[model samples]
Each structure stands twice: as C-alpha cells, then as structure tokens.
Target: MRGSGQIVNRRRMIAGAGAAVLGTLLPGGAGAGRATDNALLPKLTDGRHWRIGYAETMPYGNYAGTLASIVKGLDALSWLNGAARMPYDAGQTDSQALWRWLSAHDLGPRIRFVADGWYGGLDQAPAEPILQRLESGGDIDLMIVMGTIAGRKLAVDRHSVPTLVFSTTNAVAAGIVAAAEQSGRDHVWAHVDPQRYYRQLRIFHETFGFRRLGIAYENSPAGRAIASIADIEAMAGQLGYELVARHVQAPAGPDDQERYYADLAAAWSDLAQRVDAMYITFGRWSLDRFPALVRVFQERGIPTFSQLGPEEVAQGALMSVARGDFDGIGQFGASVIARLANGERLADMRQIYFDTPTIAWNLAVASRMGYRPAMSALLAADNIYTSLRAVP
Candidate 1:
C-alpha cells in the first residue's frame, strides 16, 4: 500500500511538472525545446486568438466537469483572465444548454469561443452539415470533443480541425485513435489511459475478493469499450471470480435517456439478486438517478464500485478512483492547447495521460455493506464521503 501510494505521488509530481513545462517530458513531445516565442505565448502564429469549438455525444456529468476543469485550467495558465467560469451545471442533461453556456461565457481575448462552432449534441443529424461547414469554411481552429461518439465524428482525417478529445472510456478501443502513443490522424489527439479500467478492477478485486462480480452496460462495440468489458473479463480470469453481466441499452437518441435509466435500474436490481458486487459502467444516466440504483446494491449489502470517478462515489458507490478537482488532466489539456497555439502538431505530441488514481470511498455505503476498511485503506483514500451527496 505504501509503495502504491508513493508511485501515485511521484506520477502526480511528474504530471504537474509536465503541465507547467508544456508536456516537455511526455513522449513524442516535438514542440519542446523550440525557440522561445514569447510574442505568441498565448496567441496563434498569425497573431490572433485561437478560435475554439466544442462538441459532445450527449450531456453527461463527467463531460461538464471536465470542461469546467479545462476552462479553469486555461485561466490558470493565463489564457483567460481568471474571471470565466463554466455556466452549465454538472448535473445538466441538456446539451443545447451547454452549447448556449459555452457560447455565452466570457472566455477572454486569448480565445475566441466560436459561438456557432457547437455541433453534435443529442441529435447528430445536424452535425454533418455543421462539420462540413467547419471542414470547408475553416472557421473552427480547434475542437474540444468530449465523448467517444463526438471524437469518432470530429477527429477523423476528413476533418481538418485539430481535435482534443476527453471523457472517453477508451479512445483506442473506440476507434478514436490509433493507439496511446499516437493518433493516426495529424489533426487528432485524445487523452488515453489504456490500463485505467484494468487498474480500477484490480483495486476493486483486491479490496473485496468478491466471488461473483456483476456489471451493466450496453452490449455493442461502443458499449463494450465504455465498460472495458475485455479488461473486466481478463481480470475475472486472473482473479478467479465469476463475471455476471446484464445488457442495458445505451442512449442512441435524445429521448432515450429515461428509458436507458429504467433499463439500468432493472439491470441493477437483477444483478443485486445474483452477484456479490456491482461495477457501474459509464452511462448517460443523470447522477441524480444513481441513488435509487445504488439503493438496490445497499439493500442486498453488495459492494459497488463506480467505473467513472469520485463524483459517482460521492453520489452512492462504495469506492472508485478519484479525480480530485481534475487539475492534472485539465492542465495537461491546457498545455496541449497552448502548444497548438504556439505551432505544435497535435499528432506529434503524446496523447497518453493517466490520472494518478486515489481511492474515493463512501463510508456510509461501506457501512451499509458492513465493510470495515483497514487503517491503510482509510489513510489512502483522498476523498471520503461520510454520506451520499445531494445530486442536483
């Protein structure tokens, strides 16, 4: 436990240094050691503020939180005046509302937040025409893609805009990138952590030693990627635990959110009856609805591990790897964008940045399961919620 904590701490220090030095330490960081261009420190080579665009598959808590972190990070890097704040709530499920907020935020003079650059929200039908305009008009200088669906759509070779992808489960598995080391397309860069989910599963298994672990997710390729199904299966094989899974429809259309949650609830209820533990996968379901789903597990005294992050753990899950304040990745992204503004090819820089995972444990949920954490485990948790937080 001490060794793991020391490693995580060392990685965090490296990440912090990398962010400050524009990821100079990262693999394939070609922009580093270039002649200093203080004149274009925050501006593009053409002496203009970079025009930034945004897109996502759908509204999700993580997307909103990640965006907020990026915006805050940019401010911290002096790209903004430190007055700009993300107007959209993390609990918001309306993508249009998010677009409106981004369009309206006072993002300072260093960044031109293209008001009309928003595309591919809940309804992807209109995204094609908008993407076509972006491809031909060349108005959007860079696009911040939030999910796997949007990453696949906008990070392709056909789209000329430099894309920075975030909030995806597995960028490589989702076909958003060639691999963690490089994005196949020059205009694409995605935050990749190939072993993130595997690490999460390993920690969960080490902590609980559950005989049968259950999971719920959509069964499609995207679904499998989102749930890290292959990783889970491998972990199950290695840990000698039975893997029980239930298929719940991932939202395909704008109106499918409610139905998806309904199916997810049913799946959780069923899994609660059969398995000793539950691994909640990333889904479009609102965080507000998680308490009821987690209640199913609590009723059965089943331990629940969230695949997302600490936010979900705060909501109800027993434990997860916490991304506290999102500072590491946020600064990593801000540095990448800064490099791009100063004339760096997106594909030439490394896309692999893993969070320094720390435990996020909910003592209330753990108590419900009658699980007592050892002194080391309790000391290791960075974010501990005594009770479930109120979701808005």
Candidate 2:
C-alpha cells in the first residue's frame, strides 16, 4: 500500500499489483499491461497545460463531499506534478483546502476550469449545453462527469475526449460501462462505489437483528440508478429480512422542495409503523430533504442508516457506510487522469472503484433508539459521533 501523503505509482500499481485486488472485488480484470514502470508525473502536451472540464447533475445538492474529493484529487495531482507546496489545514473541507492551495500557489494560470454545468434536475438544464461546451472548444483534454445520470448520458454519447465518471453508483446498471473491468467506449472510464445498502443491511441485521428495514428513495434517474427497489428486494431476500420501501417522486423545482418533504414525512410515518429500522439511500431529492427526513426518523425512534457520506453520519444518522474519501478518491482519479494526459490509452487504464469505504456511527442516535452495536462493529467504524450536534 502507498504511504500517507505519498503519490501512488500508477504505472506499476495498475499494471498488475492493483489488478490482483481489483480482479476479486470487481467483475472482470484482464488485458492490462504488466510492466512495473516508475513514471508518476502526468505528461501534458507541450506548450498547453492539461484542461479538465467538469459537469455535475446537481452541483448544489449534497455534492459537497464529492466536490471536496475532486479538489483533493486535483491538489494531489498538482503536488505530484511539481507544483509549489501550500499550507495544509485539516479543519477545512477538501474544496476549501484546494482553493487555499490554489490561491497560495497562484496556479490559476496553469489549470483551466471549463463547462462547469449543473443539470439542476432531469429537465431543468438539459445536457445539450454541456455537450456544446465540450464540442465548441475542442481544447478540453479531459472531462469529469459528477453524477450517475449525467455520467450515463455522457458515456453513451459520442465524444473523443478521455472522460472520467466520478461518484456514480452502479455504473454498469446505469449503462456507464459494459462491466467493471471494461469500458464499452474506449474514451470513457468510471469510478463507481458499490451500493452501501447491501453491506449496511447486513451489518444492521448482525448488529440489531432487525427483520424489517425501511428505505426512502427518489424516483429520478439518479435516484433509481443509485439504489433500486429491485436490488433492495433481492438483498433483503438473501439476508432473510423484509423491506418496506417508500418511493418519493423527484422534485420538479424549488416550489416542490417543501412538498417533497411533506410526502417523505408521510412515508416515514408509514414506514415507522411497519419497519424496525430505516436505511436512507442517496438521491438528490432525498438528500436535499435529509434534515427533515432524519428528524422524522428520530421522532419515531427509528434507528436509521444512511449511505451518503461522513457528513451525514456526523449530522445524526445512527450509522452509515460513508463513501466519500475525497483526498483518496481525488488522488486515485488524478493519477489516472494524469496517466491519460501522458498519452496512456483509456483501454489500458482500468476502471476502478473507491474500495476504502468509511464506517460511521452516531452514538447519540444509537442510544436514543436503545441499540448497542457489537464491540467489533464499534471498533471497525472509521468515524463516530457522540452527540446530535453537528460537527463542523
């Protein structure tokens, strides 16, 4: 494993060493180069610094964690590429930290940010503008699609730039990739994190022995793609547990935010009567209304599990398998992007998943629900909160 703060040797690691682990974790892993090369720095085209175009489905909605990760990855890329060292602050989020670093180093000139578009909802801002940005200016060397829906469309559309799809769940199911090992399109690669519901459900079963699990999800493309009712049913069957699901329609506009919450509160009330515990999956609509939904669960004395990020666990969720490791994901993605800039074929670069997931627990919520997790489970958690108070 690479040491902390050290840049990973992408050439050597991805060639074979990393493949050994990924092969087992992912579906297919073959046809990769086996050389232990030491070239770590990204090779940008002469006289032109590499430009990264970023696109998001919902930039303002629960995407801070992912944005932070992308910043961390870019920071790591700057550091490994011989940029000046900047002050590191553990207190700031990854996005904040990146801004400070960029300001300090005056790297505004070297890197360019282009086509920063957010498709607010399915119909709000169509992806055509994003495509136009990428197409009009043929200068974009790389593209980063931030959400599952946006990623799905971009991966399927014909484009020549090497693209990285980040923070998407079930990329294969969403049609972003042919398989974990193979990108159906030679120009696109995805970094997907497996659904947290299955693992969290297993843990909940082992910990509390809950037979009925309640879930609330949105009905949008991103919502359905993130965690589906069908997948939940299959997992529930395998685990010998029952699922009580509440499906909320995707919010249309700002006016629908309150309405969405009202509907979710009703759903939570309904699930509260039937289910023993709650598992909140990631969706723009559901995540935007998280505070209200969590309050509903808490008021009902339902121990809740979420699949958002550490921030959600820190807020109040009983426990969560948080999937945002901004620095780590950033480093890994940046390395791959760097390699691509250095003229490596996208086919040779394997599509990877962020495997180092963090387990987070809120002791206050656990106590309120009269649930005591096993010592092993407690010990295994990467993050723990003791109060209902939010951590800044």
Candidate 3:
C-alpha cells in the first residue's frame, strides 16, 4: 500500500501534468457519453491567436469571470499550437463592438468570431440577409451554434463554414448530428447533457428518495426541443424515477409576467400530487419568470432543479446546470472556433458544457417546507456552494 505522503505527492504530480497538457488534444478528445482521459485535455498557450464569443453571460461568470476563464482557456488552447486568442463579447449586439474589440488581434493568424448564439438561441430566423451574413464566410474559419442553432433550420445551403455546437440534449433530433455521439457530415460536437442532468437527478433521488420527478417546459419549439431528448427518459428509467412532463403554452399580452407565474404555480400544484421532485427549464426565451417560481416550489415540499439560468440560482436555488461557464466558455469555445479558423472543419467540431462550481441552497427554504437534506449526503457532494442554515 502507498503511504499518505506518497499519495499526496502523486496527486500533485498529476495536477502539474494536467496543467502541462492544456492546449494539445489528449489521447482521446471529448466525445458524447465517452469516458474522458484525465491525462489528455489539451494545454493552454500553444501560441495560436484567435477570436471567440459567448452568447450568454450570467452564471458563466459576469463579464470579468468570463474573460478570465477565456484567457486561461486560451493559455491552455495555445500551449502546443503556439496560439494566442482575440476574444469578443457575445453579449454585445453592435458590429462596431465586434470590430473594435477584435481589430487589434485579427492582424496575425486570425480566428474571428463570425457569430455565436446566446445559449445557442439565434437572434433571428434562418432567412437572408441573416442567412446571407452567415453564408458569406470571409477570413472567418468556424461557425458555432448551440442547441437550436444547428437544427434543420440552418441547413438552407450547402456550405463549408466548419461548425461546432455545445450543450445540446437533442442534437440528433435537431439534425445537428447523425446520432448521439457521431457527426452528421464533417461535423463534430462536445455536449454536457449526456451525464450532467442524470447526475443531478440521481443526487435528488438519494436525498429525497423520490421515485418520480416532474419536469415542466413551455409549450414552444424550444420546450418541445428538450422534451424530445431520449437520454432523459433512459436515465429516469435507470434511476427508477419517473418523469411527469407538462406543456403550458407561452403566455401572451403585456402582463405576460403575471400570466407566466400563474401558469407555473398551477403546474407545480398539480405536480406535487404525483412527483417526488420538480424540474423546470425556463428563462428569457421561455418565460423569464423567476422569484415567483422559487416561491411555488417552496410553498410545496417538492425539491426542484433545472437549467434555471445562473442569475436565478445565484439568488438562491439548490442547483442549476447550463451551457456556458460565462468566463471559461469563451476560452474553450474560442479554441474550438480557432481550430476552424486554422483549417479545422466546422462540420467536425461541437460545443461542450462545463460544470458549475457553486451550489446555492438555502437551509431556510428547506425548513419552511419541512425537510432537511442529509448531512452525510451534502458533505459527500461534489461541491457545496451555499449556506442556508447554521449548525446549532
């Protein structure tokens, strides 16, 4: 057996070794549902200079955090390739912002950010002049689309703007890939949903011992987009936890906020009767309803989880998983885009999701509902991000 000191030394060596390889591809690059080679996630600062973008900014770390991670990721991405990155703010809508932020860096070995969808949601439909701008690829190298961006909608023309996308649950259904883990044409992808959601659900099952979990989505294209995921059903079955799904149409009129909350309240009220836990996946696009949704789950004892945008979680929710790390996303994302700029095929790349380090749980909310998360369980958790109660 190894001594503790030897074990500690070995772990340190491992950390150093991981840092050493941040830019070059590990033995096995990221694959959908494939095991990761702890030894092989490329290193930073390979010396390649490029520009990448992040469509969404909240939980991904505010403007500052997002940039920090991108720089770190760029260091890793450029490590072997001798790459340096020219990054852009996806949150900004003006082209002048794009040009001003990117001009200085585009001078040498340029990898420009042509377009990025916030959470992969497009700013407009698949029509030219929009499609025209997308198709007219210039010094541009890769085009990345998250979630619905690559669905059947964007295949309007046969083009070679090598593409990559990330965090998609229904990639195949959306026609982005031919199968869950393989590419459709020359395309490739890195996704976060193959395991994250299932892991989150399993933790919920262990904590509350809930046999059935209810998930609600808006009755819209994007909502139905998530509902079509085969993995969710497969994972739920394996956990022996059932799914109760509801589809409430998107609200209409000026007081949409009020209507949205009212509908969600009723959904949970109905779910409480059958589900052991509740799951929601709504935000700016779906409903933009917050504080009230938080109240609904609390009023009832149903433990909840979802892709509740980082802001909502930061305010105080037990957990939320999502598309961008805000800060780190641009780095990795830009790297993938960089590959395209350098001659990597867009069709051969895909987006990937990074796990959040924070877990926001309020012990007060737990008490108001008459429940306590197991201490041993919480301690054993992958990470503990918030304090809702004090130990007496």
lDDT of 1 by residue, 1-392 (tens): 12111222223434444333322212232222222335225754454777888887766666776776676667776777643555655334455555666667666677877888776563244467757866785678888988877776777766677889998888998888888888887788998877788778877888888999998888999779767788888888888999899998777676777787788888889999999988888877766788776888986899999988776776788888765445567766777788787777878877777654567678888788888877556555666677754434
Q: Is candidate 1 or candidate 2 better by TM-score?
A: 1
lDDT (C-alpha, whole model) for all candidates: 0.72, 0.60, 0.46
Give candidate 1 misplaced runs (Cα > 4 Å): 1-45, 72-80, 83-110, 123-126, 254-258, 388-392
Ranking by TM-score: 1, 2, 3
- Model 3 Cα lDDT, one tens digit per residue, 189-293: 534334555555554565577777787766565556555435566777787877788766554543575676677668767887777677655443332345445
**TM-score, candidate number 1:** 0.79
How do all the candidates rank in terms of lDDT, highest first?
1, 2, 3
Write one digit per residue (lDDT tens) for candidate 2, span 1-392.
Answer: 22222122232323344334323323452222222234435444455666666566654323445544555555555523223354433323333334344334445434554433323343245677667666665667777777677776676555577778877757876778777776777688887545445655665566667789988887656667666455677788888887778888766776777777788778888998888888777655443346555765776778887755555655667877643234556556666766776677776676754454435677777787777876555545555677675322
Top model number, lDDT:
1
Off by over 4 Å in 3: 1-72, 75-109, 113-128, 146-159, 187-193, 219-222, 227-229, 251-261, 282-288, 308-310, 321-335, 346-360, 380-392
Worst 10 residues of 3 by lDDT: 1-10
TM-score against truth, every candidate: 0.79, 0.76, 0.64
Model 1: worst 10 consecutive residues (lDDT sum): 1-10
